[model samples]
Target: MGVQVWTWILVGITFAIYFGIAIWARAGSTKDFYVAGGGVSPLANGLATAADWMSAASFISMAGIISFSGYDGSVYLMGWTGGYVLLALLLAPYLRKFGKFTVPDFIGDRYYSNTARTVAVICALIVSFTYVAGQMRGVGIVFSQFLQVDITLGVIIGMAVVLVFAFLGGMKGITYTQVAQYCVLIFAFMVPAIFISFQMTGSPIPQIGMGGKVEDGAYLLDKLDQLHTQLGFKAYTSGSKSTWDVFAITLALMVGTAGLPHVIVRFFTVPKVKDARKSAGLALLFIAILYTTAPAIAVFSRTNLIETVSNTAYKNMPQWFRNWENTGLIAWTDKNNDGKIQYVNGAALEGKTPMFLSERGEHGQRVISNSSTGPNELYVDRDIMVLANPEIAKLPDWVIALVAAGGLAAALSTAAGLLLVISTSVSHDLIKKQLRPDISDKAELKIARISIVVAIIVAGIFGIYPPGFVAAVVALAFGLAAASFFPAIILGIFDKRMNKEGAVAGMVVGTVLMLFYMVRFKTGLVGVLDPLPESEWWFGTSPEGFGTVAMLVNVVIAVVISRVTPAPPASVQDIVENIRIPSGAGQASTH
Candidate 1:
């Protein structure tokens, strides 16, 4: 069968499995909805956690960014991996011990204030929404390209799929569903990687093949570096970002991962503190399998793309190239009217992607309506690299279909998790806790379902019209999480003297500061004014790294305010003390 037929078959089967799990394991009560009835095995939770953590960003965009940016993209690998370690060691166990299934619930009870809970809920909404946009966009990218539909239509389809399972089973459904997703996504990611690795180098293992020689017996990196210098681009192993920016982005992603409410809540699904710790460790192992392979895949895809397209006749390009071109992910402007594609480094369009013309050019390639000032004539969206890698290497139809299925699994799994967070925050944190403390579990569950549905719609909108692509948008979400929740959660746990006033003030300031910078610089829309130039960056920090500054400011503001204000009540102080007891995260009397 062809790629499209195989795509429908694989995507249909996996999605059917997800829907089946949702029906079979549907949530029975608030406990089931919130934390899978807190009975999940460590291993199961670990797999689910791995699936949840590795969103479309990890499966799709991370390597794509690395393929394009080269060594500069290593920050994502280091920061995200380091951040998981940070979460496992610094945050996850204690949060699990505290026994509030949600971050807002923890803050609300820990700080002894609904106001603080409300703030945390708002922050969670912002971060999760921002993050989910990337996941949904990833789904759209996979669907639009593989299924041959418009990206907008693709996002809508994804929204419906997520709503089915997420609405039916909540976290109970999402957990097991993620385990299946993890298997699909991981296998899909590794198979082609192995194939292309062996095809290029003698080694079948991608990690080893990355360091091995090409057919010419030249080191693979050496060949890639040679190709890069032949073009107008920097060498593949070089870094162009300032050291400060790199440090900031890495810090933001790391702490942001630690503070992400969706990831933290996974720890709550387990039965005991020991189970949480065990799951964290297992999750790291599972995560490393893909994380370690990403750089190799990046290198392979980058090298393949340059060699395949550079100076090649547009008419002679392969079927995969034309397929991607039809999706508008790639284009040719035919600068100087050359019949060959010029894949040299530079912008091929004024904007992020090519605006394609309705008609084809002289070489019968997709004509871009927009043109660039530079010499480069081709426009290839980086997000397409991982998806197109298998096709570029001429892998079988089944492998490409599996990749599409895996992309969906990765995207939908995380989308379900994030939508659940949005629902839990609204129904449990905002409505049940604040608006109607007397609301019944049935009503809250109903509300949570409604919240998930509504959240899915909003996510679809963001996917249809994103501020940026997957990694960039996800990084901003991390920045928001780091700035707002990291200090509040860490301080609330460690600082017995920390009060509600300080926590609330810190969260608000940090979130607002990060938002201001992101709007002014990243998104470029603050009350209709132009985005500030790079020269106006705060102390030369990019928006992605600015979260570290916001997080520090949050810590300082939280500390200074807590010193001047009255200390937390004796009962609250005692809760903090009990959480620190290394023996185990005991039952939360607060819960």
Candidate 2:
């Protein structure tokens, strides 16, 4: 079968499995919706957690970012992997021991104030919505490139699929379905990597193949370094970012992972503190499988892209080039009228992405109105690198189709998790806990389902008109989580003296500050205006790194306010003490 046919078959089969799981495990009560009745075994939770953690950013965009950024991209690998460790070690078990359904649940009950809970809820919404935008956009990219749909139509289809599962199964359905998704996604990612590895380096293992020699008897890295410098780009293994900026971005991603409400709530599904710890360990192992392979994939894909397209004639370009051009993710213009693609180290267009003209050139290549005056005439969106790699390498139709399915799985799994967080925050945190304390379980469940519908609509809009690349947008979400939730959650648990006033003040200021930086710099108000240049970066730190500064500011404000204000009540202090105690953790009051 052809690539599209195989894509339809694989995607159809995988999606069917997800839908079946959603119906089979559909939530019957508020408990099932919130945390799968808090009876999930550690192994199941581990697979679900791994699936939840490795989103579209990890599966679709992480390697893509590395492909473009080279050594500067190592920060993503270090920061994300390290952050999971920080969260698993410092937060997950304690949060699970507290027996709360969500992060806001813990904050509200612990801080002894609905106001503080309200702040956490708002922060969670901002973070989850921002993160889910990337997932939905990933879905759109896969559909546009592989399934040959318009990006808008693709996002709408993605929204419908997510809403069905999230509305039906809630956490119960999401968890079990994610296990199946993890299997599909990992297999999809690895098969391509292994094939490309053996094709180039005669090794089946991508990690080793990255370091091994090619047919020319030269090491892969050495050949890539030669290719990079020859093309006016920096050495592939050398770093270009300032040391402090790298540190700040890394720290931001690390803490952001720890504070993400969707990821943290995974622990709440487990029955005991020990189960949370066990799942955390198991999740780390599973996540490493992809994380470790990402850098190698980045190297292989980057090498192949440059060798295949650089200085290649438009007419002679591979079939994959024209296919991607139809999606507008990759474009070329006959700059200098040379009829050749110049994939050098400069922007190919005046804007971030290409603006394709309605007309075709003499050589039948799509014309781009936004072509720049620079020597480079090729525009390739970074998000397409991973999806296009298998095709670029001339892999089998089944392999390419599998990648499309995997990208969708990676995206949908995380989208379902994030939408669930958004819904539960509104229903469980705002409605049940704060608004209508007497609301029955049935009504709360219905409200939760409704909330998912609304949140997915908003998320679909963001996906349709995204502010940045998948990983870049996701990085901003991490920064927001770091600035807003990290300090409050950490101090609330560790500093029993921390009071509502302190946590509330810290959350408000940190979130606002992070928002200010992101708006001024990263998003440009969803294209209402142009973003400020890198020259205007604050203290040489990019928006992704500003979260570290904001987080520090939050810590200072929280600590200072806590010291001046009255200590948390004796009962609140004791609740903290009991949660930290290992022996009684399983028996602690969930209220």
Candidate 3:
């Protein structure tokens, strides 16, 4: 069979497996829909959480970002993974001990304010919707590349699949399907990295292979550093960002990971607090498998890409290059009519000359005018690196097919998790708790399904018209989560004196300030506000990293408000104490 046929076959098989799990685990009640009846095993929950957390960003975009950004990309690696540590150590156990079906449930009951819960619902929707939009786009990109479908059509198909699983199975079905997804995605990610590592450095482990010597006996990191320095780019292993910016981005991601409502909700599915903690450890372990391999994949692919295109003619470019070019991700402009493509630093230092300088020196002047003449520029979309890796490395067609399926799995799993959070917040928190307390469970389930459909449509629209900065947009979502939800939840858990006034004030102020800053810098508002130079960033933190600052502001505001106002009642203090101890796990109060 041809590659396309095999790709479809693999995708079909994955859908069948997911659909089967959804049907087999079909949720029968509100409890099932909300938290999988609160009986999921630690291992299963861990796998499901891994699937939920990975998303399209992790599977498709992360390595690509790392590949282009080099050492600077480690911020993503450390930020995302480290955030999970915060979640496991500080948040998950306590939240699971509270034994609520949804995040808003914890917020509402803990704060003793329905308004607080509603605000949380709104925040969850915004964060999840923004994040899911990117996932849907990722699915579309994968489908357009592998299945030869139009991007819009791919998004629609992906949306349909997600609706079936998420709306039909709810949490119960999504959980089991996610476990399967975790398996497929991890295998797909590792197989190519392993192959490339062995081929380039004679090492089976890609992580070690990244720093290991190349066939020419030079260290890969050292060689990449040399290439980047020659090209007038920062060294591969060093960073160009200010220390404060790095710290802010890392802190934002870490808090955002801890604050993400969808990720936090996963712990509620497990049976006990201890199980939640164990699942956290397991989730990180599964995540680390891909996270560690990702850097290696980035380094390997970057090396392979530079080596292949550095001196090759456009006509000599590989099939994968041409294929990706058709996607408009890779473009070549032949400036001087030289058949050979020249890959060099577009800008070189003035006085400090290099062996290879582009037509333009450090200044905006052209230097080497296509001495040979070829494409002046090559633009390769970062998303293509991982999806096209197997083909680039000349791996088996089955491996390519597996990657397609894995990408879909990663996208769909995260979409399902996000949809569940949105739906539960709407049906359980907004509707049942506030709007219609007397509604039947069956009716609530219907409303949850309706919410899922609506959320899916909204997310699909975003996939079609993706924001200009996909990575930064996703980071912003994390930042918002960190700023608004993380502080509220952490305070609610750890601080007995925290009052509803403080929580509500913190969430509103933090969320609003973060949104304002994001809109001002990230969107068209920058033109109106007058753009701020990179050097003028607040506290030297980039807009992308401003979530940490916003979060700190939230904490400060919350503490001040709590101190000024009255503290939580003694009953609330007792409740906090009860949540801290695991011995009362079985009889834990839902409130």
In candidate 2, stretches whose alpha carbon ends up further than 4 angstroms from where it belongs are 526-528, 584-591
Show model 3 residue runs off by greater than 4 Å. Answer: 346-376, 525-536, 584-591
lDDT by residue (314-412, candidate 3, tens digit) is 767878776765554555544544666556655212211112233433322233322332233444667778888888788888888889999999999
The sequence of per-residue lDDT tens digits that candidate 2 reaches over residues 463-559 is 9988889999999999999999999989988988999999999999999999999988877865377779899998999998999999999999999
True-vs-predicted CA distance for residue 117, candidate 3, Å: 0.8
Give the per-residue lDDT of model 1 (tens digit) for 1-591. 999999999999999999999999999899999999999999999999999999999999999999999999999999999999999998888999999879999999999999999999999999999999999999999999999999999999999999988998899999999999999999999999999999999799999999999999899999999999999899999999999999999999999999999999999999999999999999999999999999999999999999999999987899999899888887888887879998898889987788877888887877777798899998887788889999999999999999999999999999999999999999999999999999999999999999998999999999999988899999999999999999999998889999999999999999999999999989977468778889899889999899999999999999999999999999999899988887545656765
What is the number of residue pairs that collide in model 2?
0
Cα-based lDDT for every prediction: 0.94, 0.94, 0.85
Summed over model 1, clashes come to 0
RMSD (Cα, Å) of candidate 2?
A: 2.7
Ten consecutive residues with minimal summed lDDT in candidate 2?
522-531
- lDDT for model 2: 0.94
The alpha-carbon lDDT assigned to residue 95 of candidate 3 equals 95
Q: List residue ranges in candidate 1 displaced over 4 A.
A: 583-591
Model 1 global lDDT (CA atoms, 0 to 1): 0.94
